[model samples]
Target: ISYVFIVENTGNVTLTNIQVQDVLPGLMLTGGPIAQLLPGEIDSTTFTATYIITQEDLDTGSVTNSASVSSEAPRGDLNDPSDDIVDTSDDPNDSSNEDPNGDGDPDDPTVTLVNSIYDLEVSKEVDELEPVVGDEVTFTIEVANIGNVTATDIVISEQIPSGYVYVNHIATNGNISYSDITGEWTITQLDPDQVEILQVTVEVLGFGDYLNIAYVQSSVGGNDVNIGNDEDSAEVDPICLTIYNEFSPDGDGVNETFVIDCLERFPDNKLEVYNRWGNMVYSTRGYLNDWSGTTNGRAVVKDSDNLPAGTYYYVLDLGDGSDPRVGWLYINRKN
Candidate 1:
C-alpha cells in the first residue's frame, strides 16, 4: 500500500531544509522525499510500503502507520534562529526545546489497516429421503470453510422440526455441544480447506412434509464475507400406507384388483379378506397386489359361480411391528 504526507509552511517567514520520516510496524518503506518550503509555500511527499499479514495481525485485525516532519531555519535568514540552538532542551514545554520556526512539524499521526475477508458455507442432508412415522431418520450437517484465511470459533445452530423428535444421539468429528433449552448445536472452530460433518438422529412422529434448517457462524467477526450460504435447509417427505375402500372386480380391467400404495414397500406382509358374516374367505401370505376378488374357488364373472356382491372386511398385517389395520371394503360385481 501507498501513503502520502503533506507538509505546509503557514509561517510568515521562509522555512528551509524540511524533512519527513515514516515509522510503520509490520511494513517496509520503499521511497519518500521532502523538499524545502518557503513562506506561504507547501510541499507534499508520498511514501510506499508493503506488509504481509500474519496470525497476530489477523487476531488484532488492524495495523497502524505514523509519520512526522521537522525542519531547520533557512540560510541567511536573520529573524529565524540558527539550527544549532534548536536542540537546546529535552523538555517539550520549554521554549528552547520547541522549534523556533512556527512551521515546525505537527504531532505524529497514524493510519490503521483493517482485515475483513473470509467465507463459510453450510449444507444439510438426511439418510432417508422418504420417511414415515415411527421411523428413525439421520440428519447430516456439513460445514465448510471456503475462504482465503482460516476462521476461528466456528459455531452451528439447528432447530429440530416440530413433527420430528430428537433421539438424543449425535456424531461429529469435532467437539460440539447441545443445549436443550435453546434447542441448538454449537461447534468450536474451522480452518481453511477444512470440513466438519455432524450427524444427528430423529424419530418421525407425524406424517407429511417437514423442513429442517441449519445455520453457521464464526467468531472471526466482520471477516465473513459471504453470509448468503451461512444457512442451509433440507426437507423430508413421508410416504404413508393407504388402502382403497371400494373396487369393482367384474373383469372390466378397471379397478378390478385390490391395490395398496405402500404395501409393496414391505416384503413381509399378509392380507385376509372376510365377508360380512365374519368368515375369512380369502387369505394370502406376502400379499403381492394380486387380489382379483377371487375367493373359495370362485370368480366375480358374469353368469359364473362366483361370490355374490356384498360388503367385506380386510385385515392387513405389515409384520413391521406397527399396528394392524382393520377396515371395511366393498366388492361390486357388474356383469
Candidate 2:
C-alpha cells in the first residue's frame, strides 16, 4: 500500500488517461487527474495507490525492493514506466541518531545526582580561634557539599591543624570517633548541592595560634569539579570554637564538689570535678558543662554530705564549641 508522495505535469499539451510507473513496492496506481496543461504548465496531482505482495515475492534477507508500471492509449504517457522501481528498503526511516549523553544509537534515558550528604564544614567563635594552650575546648564544624554534580562515597577528614592537641573524641553528625592524625570520617554522599554536619575538636597545649580547616570530597573518581564544594541541602552554618582548662580541688575530699564555680575559674574554661580516684566526677557543656550529678541516671552523692573518695568517669564540654571535650579528673580529700 502507498500514499500520494509527489506529482509533476511538465508537457505543454494536456493528455487524457496518462499513467505512472516505477512506483514503490507493494503499491499500485489506480487513477489520477490533471486539470489542464499550458506552455508553462507546472501543475502536479497526487493519489493514494495500493497493492499486495506475498512472502514468495520477498527478496530474502536483502531488504531491497522496487516496482514498475506501463500504459497504452495515452498521449503524455510512456509505454513502460520502469524508473519508479527505485531502491526501496524495508528498514525503518530513522536508524542512526545522535546520542547526546554519549551512550550509543538512538535511545531514551537520562541521569542526575540526587540527595547528597556532603562533608563536615565548620566556623569558629570570633574570640577563640583554636583550642587553648594546655586546655581542652569545644570545637564545632558544619559540613556542606558545594559541588556541581552529586557525589558518592563522600569522605571527610581533618587534622589538628597543628598548634593544638586532641583533648577528647571528635564528633560528626552527632557521631563520636577517636581523633588522631589518621582518622577518616565518612558520610553517605552529597548531591551537587548538599550539606553535612560534623565537628572537630582539640585542646590547647603549646602556646601558639592554630588554623583549623576541615574538608569534604566525593567518593567516586575524583571529579575536580565536585571536590571541596559545599552543596548541602541546607546553607553552610558557622562554627564557634572555645578553649580552656580546669583542675579539680587538689586531691581534696573537703572542697570536693560538682559545682560550676571552680571549673569556670581557670583560663582553660573547661568544667571539671576532682574525684579522689583521679576521675572527672562532673563536667559541663562547653561554657555550660553543668553536671546534673548523675552518670546517665545513677546518683554519685554519698550520705548527702559530699562525694565519697573514689574515682569516677566524666565528660567535659570544653573547647570553642567546635568539639566537646571529655576525660577524667582527680578529687582528693582536703584535710
Best by lDDT: 1
Cα lDDT for residue 211, candidate 2: 54
TM-score of candidate 1 to 2 decimals = 0.50
| Candidate 2 runs further than 4 Å off | 1-127, 130-132, 169-181, 207-209, 226-335
**Tens digit per residue, CA lDDT, model 1, 20-120:** 55555666665444445677875544445566666555545665455555566655454554551121112223243334334453332343455645788
**TM-score of model 2 (CA atoms):** 0.32
RMSD of 2: 17.4
For this target, which candidate reaches the highest TM-score against the unseen true structure? 1
Task: Report lDDT per candidate.
Answer: 0.67, 0.41
